[model samples]
Target: MKLSILDQAPISSNQSPREALQESLKLAQAGENLGYTRYWIAEHHDLPGLACSAPEVMLGYIGSNTKKIRIGSGAVLLPHYKPYKVAEVYNMLATLFPNRIDVGIGRAPGGSAEATNALSDNFLQQVWNMPNSVQDLLYFLDNDIPTEHHHARVSASPIPLIPPIPWLLGTSKKSAILAAEKGLAYAFGQFMSDQDGGAIIKQYKDHFKPRKHNESPQVIVTVTAICAETSEKADEIALSSLVWGLQRKRGEETHGVPDIQDAKDYLRNEKDGLLDDMKKGMIIGNPQEVKKAFLTLQDQYNADEIMIVTITHSPLDKIQSYRLIAEEILK
Candidate 1:
């Protein structure tokens, strides 16, 4: 399986913007050395913890730093951005990076209502129209549809002769059907539990029809991966990072990741809801344990690619986790 890195660039307590960006670059460099196929940044707006609000700009930086690893959005949160603009940005990246840029698109806003409203006026409508809007965006990027014939036309300068590989990022069956119909690759989020990735992969492969851009179906699974010396250590590291997600679910708007002490204290006081959520879907363990779990997932889904998202309070810890996984499971 091909290994890739997915980063939300979570800002930890006492970390500045510059520090976060530098840390992300360090992680990207580490992934490159570890033989990862790609490094993807997630888009999340108006959130203090997530500094990857502008993935395209961040991708340009990542592209400049890494020599061989591919750089792109794990997802660009298509709903908030204009489809034409996204096509142009990704096309430019592909041109700059040649064969090393990927464009993974998703429907979610990756933020709360207040944040979404702050980013765009029509965020809700844009999200609702994503399935159709993305189709149009793909058409413009892949084919030269004339402006006169079509009411709207989007043209890019130094047009991307080589199209970026398209990936549909979702955690639902609806996304699977759309990906299959479009013959695009699908990446299932590891956080979701109601949807079975194996079933979706089967549906995608069975119903796939080749388009001009894609000749076959490709399935990728994105999982929360934290590999350390032992399962207990991995879990401890993961628990702290995961508290941010739990807080979000609880409608709390906090910026930056909490410290291990803070997370431990919070978990001790509150009910185990957050901890339960993490254990239910996450993969946190040592090399052997993680490998066993991942192998089962791969075997069940017959996944073509695996993207690992390592969430941590420290960049060094994050890089170490990914490094351990690459050295042991991926080797």
Candidate 2:
């Protein structure tokens, strides 16, 4: 069982993005030392609280700071990018750090309409053609061109000896099926959904096709967690993240992660089911309790890796959570 991290460069109301980013770098190095297999950063636009807009740019910085943990995008929105450009950038990364980069793609806009438009024109049209774009990306990476292929002349330059692994991010069975058909590994965002993902994972594994990078089915389950010394303390520390999830759902413009008092204040006014919904994929408990809870998901999903996404108002808590998990469970 391997543990990995998915950092979104969380910002708290009390701190600036500069501090959040520095913490992200420090956390990545800490995870590397703690025996984490990978450290992937998420790309979110138009969300002030989520300070990671350019995961590719951050990957270079993270790769340089960490020794062994694989550094890559938790997801790069495929629809917004030209496949060739994505290939070129990640290819360069692979050259710099061989056998340690992952190219995870997602279909979500990662922002609002205005932000999507800011990224590219006809964003939805590109989204509608996502399958084609993914195929193009694969072809570019493998340097393959079908007979009479429209892009026969095009090629991803400076192809490294070790290519970045392709990961498809999704939250449903349909997404799993699509990944299987494309011969790509699948990562289910259990953190994003409020449902059990065992069925979808089963579907993906049953239908997966063998490819060069993955001859067998590969699956990673990403979920939220906050580990501390005690359950009460864990819940208190997780307050900010719990509130942030609700805020994102309510369509409110979040600044940074909020404090325990803010979380309590927000929950007092919100609907009864809001916290319930946020708790669906989250594991909040002490070190031993968290280990037990995590094992349940890992068992149900039969996961190759369990990716943890932690959020806290304090960088110290965030680092400490990963540290406790590493010392008590991951090792």
Candidate 3:
């Protein structure tokens, strides 16, 4: 099974956005050294603890610091941007990094309503036209815009010898069918989705139509997980994220990822059901246990790759979690 990373560049309560980004670089370098197949950074806007908003810029920085691991946007939130512009940005990255660039397209706003509106006009309309947008993006990437089309006279320039690859990213069957029909690679956000991922991936493969760049269906399952030397340690680390999530949902002003002691104190009076709801979404365990869970999930989804997203109050713990998992799985 192949393993990769999905990073949100999470900020700790004690840290700044700048620190979180530095950690992102550290984690990406660590992932490459640990034999991870890819390292994808998420794009989030006006989110308190998540640092990255422009993945294309971050990719350039990360690509310069790493040698081989594939780097990309976990999802670029394509609805907010023009297809040609997106293509040009990634094409420049591909020109710089060659075969190492991946453009993971998504339709979600990736931000609050106001933030979304600020980013683009008619975001809903753009989402409704996603199929056409994706087609145009692909055409721009390939420099294959139909001659009769209005933008055919223009081209996404500084194109690399080998183009950046496109992957459709989402958490639903609608996205699966879109990716299938477009003949693009599919990445399921299993970490965030409550839907039947197995059936969704099946839908993608079952309906996939081969295209020039992608001749077969490709699927990657992105999941949330935390691994450590001990299950107790793993759970403690995970609690920080849980508490932060609970606070966010309640519209509490979060300082950032709270310390473990703070997380414990906050959750002490909370219902077990609420905690269980949060815990159910994450895989928390020691190395051996995490390895087993990951393999099982891989089998369940028949995924081409398993991409893990881990966040914690301590950046060291976050990096160690990935290292522990890699030792077990990449071996």
Candidate 4:
């Protein structure tokens, strides 16, 4: 199984947003050195804990910092930007990096309602035209259009000798179907939803159609993994993410990812289904345990690639987690 990264630039306790951003580049460098296939960044806005809001800008910075690993947005909230602009920006990146770019588009606003409102003039209208927007993105990326089409002459330019690999981040059958229709690669965000990722991948494979714009069907599953020397330690690290989940559930964005003790204290008196919800998309254990869980995840999802998002409180532990996964499961 192939291993990749989906870094959210999470700000942990005693860490600043700038430090988190710096850690992202360091993590990418470690990912490349550890033999990870791709290092993808997440886009989140108005979130005090997440430092990366513009993935393309970070992509360039990460690309320059590393040599071989593919760098891109885990899912650039496509609804917030124009497809032409996305195509052009990524096209330029592809030209610079050649084969080491992956362009993953997603519908998530990557922000709250207020941030979403600020991102676009008509948020609901953009949501309505998402499918059409995706189509436009695909067309512009390939610089191909039906000769009879009205905008056949228009081209979103800086056409690269090698186009950035296009991927659609989906968590549902609807998303899978759209990827199938466009013939773009599919990446299921199991960490974002409670739905069955295996079923989603199954439907995507079953309904996949061929498009001249690309090659064979591709499927990637992005999930969270936190590993340490011991199961107890791993669980302690996992608390940070648990607190993050809790904050989101309460409609309050966390400041920086708190420490393990703080997280445990926050949830100590309160017990709900949040832990169960967190487990749906995460695995926390020692190296051997994490490897086994990831293997099972692979067998269930049958994905071509597995992208791991490890956002622990310590930058070193987060990097260590990725290294352990690469040394253990990915090997």
Candidate 5:
């Protein structure tokens, strides 16, 4: 199975944003060396524990540092920007990287309500007009705006010889349908969504309408996982993210990912069931067990690739987890 990374640039309790981004670059380099297919960075804003706010900018740094493996935005949060501008930025990236860029798009605001307000004038309306925006963006990328269209005379400049591949990132059936209708590859964010991923992906394939000759539906399933030499160690590493996620859900502001020991202490008074529920959406195990879980998800979603998101208090541990999973699965 094809393996890839989806990095959120999670900041550790004692690490600066610069350090987290440096870790992201190291992870991308490691992924390429391990024979992974892609390395996608996420976009987040006004989130203390997450460092990335501009995936395009991060991709530039990563692309210069790594070779071969595809580099992209996990999802560009399309609702906040103009289609033409988005096309211009990624098209320039495709030109620089040359057949190694993927432009993953999403409609989510990618931030809190206040952040959303700060980023866009009318976030909801922008989301409601997502389909048209997607079409416009795609047309700009292809440099094929219809003559009758209002913006026909304009162009998304710096067009590359080969355009970047577009993947629609979503978590629901409506998103699946939109992706299918647009003939874009669909990436389901299983780590974030509570929806039936298999059903959603199946719906995407069922409704897929090719925009180009010989085009076919493509799928990627992104999941949260932590792999180590032993299941116990993996579970221990996962606690940091689990506790941090809980705090976020409870509307608590955290400085960064708590230390593993701190996570253990915080969970002591919490209900055991809360931790169990969080684990339901995550695959925390040894290398072999993690591989098995990934295979199950692959078959269930009929996915072409598995994009993993691993968060830990130590950046080294996060890199180690990816190494363990890659060694076992790619072997």
Candidate 6:
């Protein structure tokens, strides 16, 4: 199976944005040597705890350092940007690293309504226009006729010699159906729900109709993975990382990654119901256990790719965990 890395650019109290970005690049470089297919960064706006507000910029940085691994956004919030501008940015990247960039699109806001409105004036209207936005993006990349002759048309320089792989990222059934109908690859967020990924994949494949761009349905499942030498250590690390989501759900805004002590304290006061919900969708364990769990999902879903998001209190621990998984498990 193919492996990829996805980063939320989690902020830690001790590390600065520059430091976190440096470490991310190091991890991407290491992942390349270890045989990962791609390294993707997520986009989040106005989140103090996340530094990946602009994934396209981060992608360029990563692409400059790594020679073989493909780099792109796990998703760019399409509703917040103009379709022509989005196409131009990705098209340029694809030109710079021919056949090495993948554009993953998502419809979610990625942040608060206030933040979304701040970024785009017509936030609600943009959400409603996502389907058309995607269609327009595809048209721009393929150099097809513009929808309206009166509207401005943007084209890429050195014009993309080859089409970049387009992926539809979603955590819901609506995304699955839309992806299939449009003949695009589908990526399911396994971190968000406990619903059987196999079922979602089956639904996508059954309804998929091949288009000129996509001949077959491709499915990727992303899960939170924390691998250590022992299950106990992995669980401890995962718990600390899981606290961030808990804090977010409780309407608390944290600036950096919390220490184990702080995370433990937060969990102590939080309701048990919230904690239970967080644990349902996560996979955290030693190499062997993680491998076993992932294999189960792979077999059931007939997964084409397995993407892993590793979260920890320290950058070193996060990188180490991924390295361990790569060497001891995925290898």
Better of 4 and 6 by lDDT: 4
Query: Model 5 Cα displacement at 98 (Å)?
Result: 0.6
TM-scores, in order shown? 0.92, 0.94, 0.98, 0.94, 0.98, 0.93
Predicted structure with the largest lDDT when compared to the true one: 5
**Count: clashes, candidate 2:** 1
lDDT (CA) for every model shown?
0.81, 0.89, 0.93, 0.86, 0.94, 0.82
lDDT of 3 at 67: 90
lDDT value for model 4: 0.86
List candidate 2 segments past 4 Å from native: 265-277
Candidate 1 off by > 4 Å: 146-154, 253-255, 271-274
- TM for candidate 3 is 0.98
Candidate 4, residues 1-331: lDDT per residue as tens digits? 8889999888987888888899999999999999998999989998878889899999999888789999988888888888989999999999889999899999888888999988887877887898999888888888887788667898877889888888999889899988988788899998877898788888888888877745778888888899888998888888888887678678785778888888888988766775866665678889899888878888999988889888778888898888877888767
Candidate 6: clashing residue pairs, number: 2
Better of 1 and 3 by lDDT: 3
The worst-scoring run of ten residues by lDDT in candidate 4 lies at 272-281
Residue pairs clashing in model 5 are none
> What are the per-model C-alpha RMSD values against the true structure?
2.2, 1.8, 1.0, 1.8, 0.9, 2.2
Please write out the lDDT profile of model 5 over residues 20-116, one tens digit for every residue: 9999999999999999999999999898789999999999999999889999998999989999999999999999999999999999888899999
* Alpha-carbon shift of residue 13 in model 4 (angstroms): 2.7
Error of 5 at 280 (Å): 0.1
The lDDT-based order of candidates, best leading, equals: 5, 3, 2, 4, 6, 1
- Winner on TM-score between 3 and 6 is 3
* Better candidate number, 1 or 4, judged by lDDT: 4
Count of clashing residue pairs in every prediction: 0, 1, 0, 0, 0, 2
